[model samples]
Target: MHISRQQTESAERGPRARTRKLMLETATRLMQSGVTPSVSEVAEAAEVSRATAYRYFPSQAALVHAVVDEALGPILDWKADVPDARARVGDLIKTAMPRIDEFEATFKAALKLSLDQWAQRQAGTLGSEPQFTRGHRVELLRDAIAPLTGTVPNDARERLVQALSLVFGIEVLVVLKDIWGLTSERAQSVAEWAAAALVDATIREAGNGA
Candidate 1:
């Protein structure tokens, strides 16, 4: 019974992939419950040895990033398919808004951890933990508005993206749903409308300049 090299590698990778997935799922559950767990804590929860978990995630930052990525699921692969920035931005928001209901808890937990780290850094008590930087929307928004080269002036492009960013992501839910008591559907509608309005405003500003 001789196994090819590719087959041998697959057999070994199978177990490692499953173990990493289990750890991610366990960490996601803890995060959804409003706890930003460390690597060792997740290992304990997943019933894996600390050494094995460390082999997968070297630090808490790595563990949190993976958990958030899992929560994001398909969102990280979104691409703009239309030449119209307005349509692309609207589509992106609608696509992401649906996931808000499913991953709201995880998003909030991540936000809490970010705040904790920020405070620690401000007070100069932060340890060696690498900063958990989060700004995925910056790049996504830039991609979403890439088609605005003609519709939006270059000077106004970044500002438009920044304005639209304010209305994207979990912050939309935190404002419209949590504060204003809007349903998820209503919140999504608001986001889409806001995005369209920004694009329109940018176009108008460009026209005025031209």
Candidate 2:
């Protein structure tokens, strides 16, 4: 009897994994389709019971975060092999921009969730929902600028990271493509140029102690 119970538990694990994957994939498709769906909406779209979906993702924030993480899997896996800080930053921008473009809607939906949470929190209506904080760009920018540590002061490194964040994500896409009406290639080129220029200027300023 105990052996049968153990086998049943093992057998149940596969379906649980499949259910979670289905929920994530469904959420991604919805977000990519330009709808920032709630967990229940995703569950309905996935043909999953709302209860089951909630078991996997308890709230809208959790669901949106999972979708964002899925879309960012490629960028998260990126590694810079060269040691030059400027070259590394350029490489990261080149690698990231294309993927960022590919997942633009997903990232934007994630941003919307963040903004909504911020507004709710400010109004003291945020309740018990988990907060969705954005930090991927912070870590990625720091890594891209890691080779600058010996030459640039820690504070300056942080400032460079802050500056690069301006051009690093879907917000840049909106500024460059939507507002400026630049082509995708042009937008990417501009961002890469800006990133490299920031690295050079930051290093130069540090050298002069300015």
TM-score of each: 0.90, 0.91
Model 2 TM: 0.91
Off by over 4 Å in 2: 1-13
lDDT of 2 by residue, 1-210 (tens): 223323533675775878888888999998988888999999999999999999989999878876777787668767787889999999988988998899898988888888988999999999999998777888888999998888899999999999999988999998999899998899999999999999999999998988
In Å, residue 20's CA in model 1 sits off its true spot by 0.5
Error of 1 at 137 (Å): 1.2
Write down the lDDT of every candidate, Cα atoms only. Answer: 0.85, 0.87
Clashing pairs in 2: none
Candidate 1 lDDT over 1-210, as tens digits, reads 934334533565765888887998999999988888999999999999999999989988878877776777657768877988888998899778888668999988888888899999999988998888787788789999998776666779999888998999888899999999999999999999989999888888798985
**Model 1 steric clash pairs:** none
